[model samples]
Each structure stands twice: as structure tokens, then as C-alpha cells.
Target: MPWWVEYGRSFFPVILAVFLLRSFLVEPFRIPSGSMIPTLHVGDFILVNKFTYGIRLPVIDKKVIDIGVPQRGDVVVFRYPPEPSTDYIKRVVGVPGDRIGYYDRVLYVNGEPVTERVKAQALREDGQEVLRVPEQLGEHRYQVQWVPQRSSRQGEVVVPPGTYFVLGDNRDNSKDSRYWGFVPDENLVGKAFFIWMSWDSQRFAVDWRRIGSAIP
Candidate 1:
């Protein structure tokens, strides 16, 4: 045994154990965009349940254990397809073999329009062009925003097996499958279920209302 290895033998297991714990358990992430707005806000600290999907070797992203699959309405954090180092948050809109379409700001799943009843739209004076769209997705209800007259990314996509389609609640602002492509099942990190805190220098204050809120 190398001197360094023997010197830390007593603590080697402890160090490796911590690595295994974080690799297969919960991981922390900070929200950097409004893509998941209302559900998760900028600066909000979040915890992702890694084992909910399956167990994958860290860094390599190869699943070694088959635990289960992602369910509809689950908010997830994943690596951006174009940039793996960067992480993104979005709601699972279409699962494997599901047909997903978007037109006129409405979502259609499997050839049927997923119902969304608009509640209200807010025009913020911050010049960011944000309009909130609150709707009930089956039993799960949440608010998303549609930027006025900014509907640019529009199209239809059929999710393929071993891949999932994701969309941001800030539909008009999010760069998701609509722009890039489907997220490989292996790329999924975990489900995001809470908003621990939020802050934006542009907003200039901590959003107390969002604290401790359960992500819908």
C-alpha cells in the first residue's frame, strides 16, 4: 500500500462513504433562471431526490440500478443537452413515447389538449415582459408566464423511448425541448420538490412569499 493510502486508511472509508451518499442521495442546486418560475424562482435553493429515478454512477451518468421511472407533473433538474455542465429545471410534460405539441400557447399531449384554464396575467413594470399564466394541470396546479407578443419558439415533438420532454412554466422564456431536444432518461438528476429561498439583484429584495413553498 502506498504511504498516503495507508496513512488515511482509517478515514478512507469515511471519505468514500460521503461521496457515495451524495452520488446516490440528495443533491443541492440553485435556481438561476425563471424557466421554472412560480414553481422555482431565481436564487431559490433546491434539493433533488437522486434515487427517485434510479442510481447512476456520478459524473459518468450511467445508471447502474433500476429504481423506477419519472412520473408526469414531477419537477425535475437535469443537465442541459447542449451544455452538460449547466443544469436546468423544468416540468416533465411528455414521457417516453408520448406525443407533445404546442401551438398558440396551448399544450397537447397524446393528441389531446392538456387542459389549462387561465387564471390571471400580471404585467410587471420591470420591463422583463413577463405575464403570469395560472392553470390546473390535472390535479397539479401552478402558474406560468407568457411574455406578451414574444411567442417565438413553437413546434411539435414526439418523445422517443429512453427520453423525456420537458418545459418551463415560463413557457415563453424557457429554452427547453422546444429549442434543443429531449432529455435522455440517463441525464435526469432528480425531482425538485421545494423552494427554500429566492432572491434576485434585479428585484432587489428577498421574495418572502416564495420561501418554504412546495413546488407544484
Candidate 2:
């Protein structure tokens, strides 16, 4: 047998296993922005359950099976609609056919206000004070940040079928569905579930507290 053929035979199983695992089981991703602050942080390395929403062919992102649907407040990762090559992470604020409203930093779903409590505040390096607001979205609970005096886009939008409305935890700073419109169902990648590592980009140190944390 040729040397190349022998090498292919030896490595084929391992390569195929990895591909299947990543395409349908789990995949690793890194947080490149503060969109999911508090719940997720910049530089946080996360694991997304690829099969949670269904099995999608890798690279093409075409769902081949219907296993599950995205729910309100689920931390989800998807491809940016305008730029399919870019991946983004946000919390699902509105499911298909739901009326979602945002005004004065308060969120409403189907005309009912989603519960939000101001818990605390954190100061950013830029001297901005971000309020720690805990929100209850249906069955899920998570923390979101709001910068007082920071202008944000606010309005109501009815989530269309086969699409979802998502928002960043950093409410005032993120450009999410409010600005870009809905995320098509086909754009969904997976549900973000866990943080495997966290690196403080500014401090150049590991954020031990964020590591191994579960994403809400």
C-alpha cells in the first residue's frame, strides 16, 4: 500500500468523529464582543449544544432535522443575517408571532411586561455605569446590563414566522435585532450553554469566576 493511503486510513476515523461531533453534538466558540455581558463576557470561551435546535450541516448551516425550537430567553448563537459568515450571540427575546416591545429599557412580550429588577451596578473602564438588571423571560432568568443616559433603539415589533427577535445583554450598546431585523430560523446555529474558559482581555489574566459557568 502507498504511504499516503496508510496515513489516510489511520487518521480517517479520528477526523470523522471530530467532524460529526462538531456538526451535530457540540462546538466551541469565543465571545468577541460584550453583547452578552454579565451572562457572557468578552473573551469567554463557550460550548454550544449544536443539536439543541436541530442538526445543521456544518458551513452551509442548513437544518436537516427538526429537533427543537428556540425559546424565550434562551441564550442563542446564530449567523448574522446581513453577513452570514459572521456569528453572533444573543438572548431570544421574541419567538415567532409574538409581539415584543421595548421602551425606556423595559421589555414587553405579547403586551405583558417581562419582569425586570434592578439589582446592582458595575462600572466600566470608560467610566460608564452599567446597571445590573435581572430579567425573567418566561421560564428562564438572566442578568442584563443597562447604561443609564445611553441612548438605545426602542420600539415594538411583531416577530414573524420562521424568525426570531434577539437582543444583547448590554442593552444600550448592542446592535441586535432591533437594528438589523429578525434572525431567520435557518440562521440559528445552536444554544449556548456553558463557559469553558474566560480571559480578561484588559487584565491579561484568567477570570476564574466566569470559567465553568452555565449560560442562562
Candidate 3:
């Protein structure tokens, strides 16, 4: 065999193995927006556990096998459906087969309102009043904000099987499932659980307090 051919055969499999391991084991992500603010701030560097949803192929995003399904309240990173190369991070509000609804800023799942209570009302950096919902989803309780008078993207969506609906904690500013559509199981990249670092260009400094914070 030609020396070049012999080298190619040996090198290809080694390259494939490394790519698969990085894609399925852990992937690095950078937060580009304030959609998940408070939980994940803009400029935060995060690591996503890719195999948590399932073992998906890199680049193509095909699920050849299944590991498990997403549970409600899990923070996830995935490809934006309209633009696959763009990535997004949000909380899983509805899983496959869930009946999700948002009416007048209240969230309802399976016809039962996901109970919420007021935590605090505050003004955002943009001078908008935000109503914070400190609600329990399963065993997890996290804060989500709603801005009164701001047009809310409201709708009732029956999540199809092998898909999930997600939203951001900064609800009003987020372009989430409410805007685009459900995230396919295959599109899932992984669960984002921690922030290793954060920096805000506007502030011109590192957000030292956000470093090492867990993504709720």
C-alpha cells in the first residue's frame, strides 16, 4: 500500500474518536445574551453535559441511540431551530407530551398552573419593571421575570414527542420556545449546570460574583 494511504487509514479513526468524545462527553459554550440572566449572565463561559439528553452525533446532530429524555426544569443548551449554528440556553419548561400554556403572564402545564409567588418587583437595566415569579417546578424552584405592558408571546403548545419547550429566566427579553418552536430531542446539545466565568463588556469588568455559580 502507498505510505500516504496507510497513514490516512490509521489517522482517520483516531480523529473520529476524539471528535466523538468531545461532542458527547462535554462541550464548551459562551452565553451571548441576557436571556438566562440571573441564572446565566451574558459572557458567561459554561460547560454542557452533552450525554445527558442522549448521545448525539457532532456537526450533524443526529441521535443514533438514546440515553434518556429531558426532565422538566433542566437548563439546556441547544441549536436554535431557525438558525442551527446559533446556540441558545434556556430552562426546560415542557417536556414531550406536555400541554403548556401561558396566559396573562401565568404559566400552566397540563392544565394545572405551575404555582408561583411574587419574590420581588424590580426595574431592569433597560428601565422596565419586572415581576419575578419564584415558582416550583418539580423539586426545583427558580425565578422568572415578566414585564407588565410588554407584549408577551403567549400561546398554548402541545409539545410533540421527542421534543421539549424551553424559556429563559429573563422571560420578557428572551427569544425562546414561545417565539420559535419546540427544540427537537436531536437538537439538544446538553444541560448547562455551572458557570466557570463571566464578563460584561458594558460593565468593563469581570462579574466576580457570578463566577463558580451554579445554573439554577
Candidate 4:
């Protein structure tokens, strides 16, 4: 075989394998915004389980295999409904056929208020008082941040079949389902499971404590 042909044959399989793994197995994503603050911080690099919610063909995002469905409270990454080419991460607040509501920083599912308890208080970068609270949605319990004094949008809507309602943990700052709309099942990319690394750009340092932290 020609030298060039031999080199191409040797590397093609390796490249193809990596493409399949990332497309159908797992993928890494960076948190680019503080929408999920108190849970997922900006600069946190997370690994998502691509197969957790079933396998889908890459690019097209059409599911070809059945595996699972996103549950309430599961942190997920999906193509932004309004802009399918962009990816956004948020916590699932309502699954198919559920009524979800957000009013005055409180969350309600199916007309029953989700349980939450204040955990701590801290000042935001803007010097606003923020409350850290543990909110329970189904079997998942995670902390969410709330700035009560900040004006926030709120409303109620019934999630249609094959769609999900999601919200960012940073209640007042996030532009999520409360703004754009529900995430279609086809738009789902995967469920975020781990924070493999974190970098603090402002301090120009690696946050050692956030490394290897599992996404709640």
C-alpha cells in the first residue's frame, strides 16, 4: 500500500470511534452562564450521559433508540428551543402532562407547591441579598438561589406530551422555560451527571473543590 494510504487507514478507525463515542455515549460541555448558579457555576465543565435519555442520531437529534425519559429535577442539557443550534442546561421542572407554575419565586407542579426550605443567605456580586434554598422535586433535592427583591417573570403552563418544562436554579436571573417555552423531547441532548473540572476566570485559578463533583 502507498505510504499515504497506509497512514489514512491506520487513523480513520480511531477517529471514527471517537466520533461515535461522543455522539452516542457521553459528551463534555462547559457551563457558560450563571443560570444554574448554586448548582452549576460558570466555568464548570460537565459530562453528560448521552444514552441516559436514550440514543439519538447526532446533528438531526432524532431518537432511534428507547432508553429513558427525563424526570423532574434531573439536570439536563438540550438544544435551546428557540435556537436549536445552541445548547442550554437547566433542571427539569415538569415532564409530559404536568402543570408547572412559577410565581414570586415559588415553584408549583400540578398545582401543588414544591417543597423548599431556606438554607443560607449570601450577598451577590451586585450586593443583593440572595437566599440559598433546598428545593425538592420528585426524588431530587437540590439547592436553588433566589433574589426576592429582583423583579422576575412568572406564569403557569401545562407541559404538552413530548415536551418538558425547565428552569435555571438562579430563579431571578435565568431566562428559561418561563421565557422561551418547553423543550421538545427531540431537542434533548443528554442528562448532565458530573463536573469534571472548574476554572475561575475572574481569579485565573482552578477551583480544586469543584473538580470531580457529581451534578445533583
Candidate 5:
């Protein structure tokens, strides 16, 4: 065999294996915005379990296997409904057939207010006061930031089948489903489960504390 042919044969299988594993198993993604701040930070490298919600063909994102659906409070990454080429991450707030509402920064599902309590007070980018609170959804609990002085998008709607309602943990700073609309089931990429690495580009260093941290 020619030298070039031999080299290609040796490396092709390894490359194909990696591609299949990443496409069907777990994939790595980097956080690029503070929409999920406090839960996921900019520059945090996260691992997403692709098979958790079932296997889908890469690029096309068409599911071919039966698996579980996203649960409330699960951090998820999905293709932007308006711009399919772009990916966005947020916490699932409502699954199919659920009535979801957000008014004055408080969430109401099925006419019941989600349980939350003040955790602390902090300042926003515009020097406005914001409250940090822990909100419980299903069996998961996480912190959310709310700016009381700023008006929040408010309304209630029934989540349609094959779609989901999502919101960012940083309620005041995020532009999420409240703005663009529900995420289609087919747009789902995976469930974010952990932060494998973190980098602070502004400081030009690695954030050792965030390394290997589990996603809440």
C-alpha cells in the first residue's frame, strides 16, 4: 500500500470513533454568556449528556431513539428557535402541556407560585438593587437573581406539545423564552450536567475552584 493510503487507513477509524461518540454520547460546550450566571459562568467548559434525552442525528437534530424528556430545573442547551444555527442554554421551566407564567419576576405554573426565598441582595450592572433567591422546581433547587425595580416580561401561556418553556437563572439579565418563545423539542441539544474546566480570560488564568464542579 502507498504510504499515504496506509496513514489514512490507520487514522480513519480513530477519527470515526470519536465523531460517533461525541454525536451520540456526551459533548463538550463552552459557556459564552451570563444568561445562566451563578449557575453557569462565561468561559466555563461544560459537559452535556446527549443521550439523556435520547439520541439524535448530529446537524439535523432529529431524534431516532426513545429516552426521557427534560424536567423542570434541568439546565439545557438547545438551538435557538429564531436562529437555528445558534445554541442557547437555560433552565427548563415548563414541559409539554404545562401552563407557565412570569410576572414581576415571580414564576407561576398551573396557577401555583413556585416556592422561593430571598438568599441575598446584590447590585446589577446599572447600579440597581437585585435580590438573589433560591427557587425550587421539581426535585431541583437553584439560585435566581431578580431585579425588582426593573419591569419583567409577564404573561401566562400553555406550553404546547413538543415544546418547552425555559428561563435563565439570572432573571433580570437573561433574554430567554420570555422574549423569543418556546424551545422546540427537536431543537434540544443535551442536558448540561457539569463544568469540566473554567477560564477567566480577563484575568488570563484558569479558575481552579470551578474545575470539575457539578451543575446545580
Candidate 6:
């Protein structure tokens, strides 16, 4: 009956709808670094499907519904283990109970190499030349890049249950699972599936070609 109650009645529904959609449906994220360079570029505005894995409540990140789990080769966004406040995006290389190895610029799972082609060079957003490879991980096919002459991490680790090993598309330049550790199931934010907009900060230009492109 009061003025404040009337104002709340008009706006409460709209605010609640937005909150529910962002928390349970899809969320937007911006690429701030070149970690996933070839697949995702810096300044790219992307969308993450929150319900791809499962329905987790917002803030505390507790899953109340069973839907799905992360799969190999899927590009996912998760909270950084070292700092849960930070969200990181990477490709899932090793799922639960999988053995992973990286040597000679090749990735191996369960002692078998994941198929990839010869390195093809590409220009980075910063104008540096980096080597790229067309690799297939499960059903997802994508390209990964690395700086020539830079040393990358190489080691073998068994992915623990309820955790996954992830790596950036920019191999040598990225400090990912190779540097820290695996991503826990609960830390996952969502699956990155689309790029709605792209802004190349270096050239100060909008990449119209990348706009509306689906992220593979």
C-alpha cells in the first residue's frame, strides 16, 4: 500500500528473472588473456552455459541436480583452485582416473598420444609468431598454439577421481594444470560455447568476423 511497496512490486519480478537466468542458465565472460589463443582470443566476449554440467546453486556452488559431467576436450570455465575468486578457462585433457603425459609437444592419455598434426605457425595477438597444431581430443577438434623456443611443462600425472586436468590452448605461454593442479568438479562454472563479440585491444578494432561465431 505504501510508495516503496509499489515500487518493489514493479521492479522485483524483472530483477528476479535476470538473477535466475544468469545464475542457472547462461553467463557472459570476457577473454582477458591469450591463454586460449587459437580457440579464444583476448578481448573476446563469450557466453558460458551454466547448466551444461549440472545445476549448481549460486554463490556457494552446491549442486542439487544431476545433469552431466565435464568430458575430455571440452573447453570449460572453472574457479581457480588456488584462488576461487578467479575464473579460468581451459580444455579438459584428463578426466577422472585418466593418465596424462606431455612430452615432445605431444599429449598422451593412458600412454597413447592424442592425435595432432605438424606444427603450423600463426601470428599471436601481440604480433608474435607461435606454433599451432590441429588436434583432436575426443569429439572436439581444435587448434593449440605455443611460442617457439619457449620451454613448456612436461610431466605425467594421473587424473584423480572427481577432478580433471586442463590446459590452455596456448601451450607454452599458459600456466595451467601443468603449473598448478587439476580442477575440481565443484569449481566448474560452465562450458564456454559461443563468442557473441570480439574486441582486439591491440589494434583497437572490433573483430566483426568473430562476432556471432560459435566456439568449438
- The local distance difference test score of each candidate is 0.80, 0.88, 0.82, 0.89, 0.89, 0.89
lDDT of 6 by residue, 133-188 (tens): 87888889888886777776788999999999999998887889999999999999
The superposed Cα distance between candidate 6 and the true structure at residue 85, in angstroms, equals 0.9
What clash pairs does model 3 have?
Answer: none
Question: Tens-digit lDDT track for model 2 on 1-216?
Answer: 999999999999999999899889999999999877778888999999989888877676677899999999999989899998899999999999999999888889999878465455566636776688878887788878888878878799999999999999888778999999999999898999999999998999999988888887
C-alpha TM-score for every candidate: 0.84, 0.93, 0.84, 0.93, 0.92, 0.93
Runs of candidate 2 with Cα error greater than 4 angstroms are 2-4, 115-125
Instruction: Give the lowest summed-lDDT range of ten residues in model 5.
Output: 117-126
Give the per-residue lDDT of model 5 (tens digit) for 80-192.
99998898999999999999988767788888878465455566654667777788898888888877777778899999999999999989889998999999998998999
Candidate 4: the clashing residue pairs are none
Please give, for residues 11-72, the per-residue lDDT of candidate 4 as tens digits. Answer: 99999998999999999999999999999989999999999989888777678999999999
Scanning candidate 6 in windows of ten residues, the lowest lDDT window is: 117-126
Cα RMSDs, all models:
3.3, 1.8, 3.9, 1.6, 1.9, 1.7
lDDT of 3 by residue, 135-160 (tens): 66886778887777788877899999
Over 4 Å off in model 1, which ranges?
Answer: 1-18, 115-118, 200-206
Worst 10 residues of 4 by lDDT: 115-124
Sequence-dependent TM-score of model 4: 0.93
The candidate, 2 or 4, that scores higher on lDDT is 4
Error of 2 at 31 (Å): 0.5
Q: Is 1 or 3 the stronger prediction by TM-score?
A: 3
Error of 6 at 167 (Å): 0.1
Of models 1 and 5, which has the larger lDDT?
A: 5
Candidate 2, run of 10 with poorest lDDT: 116-125
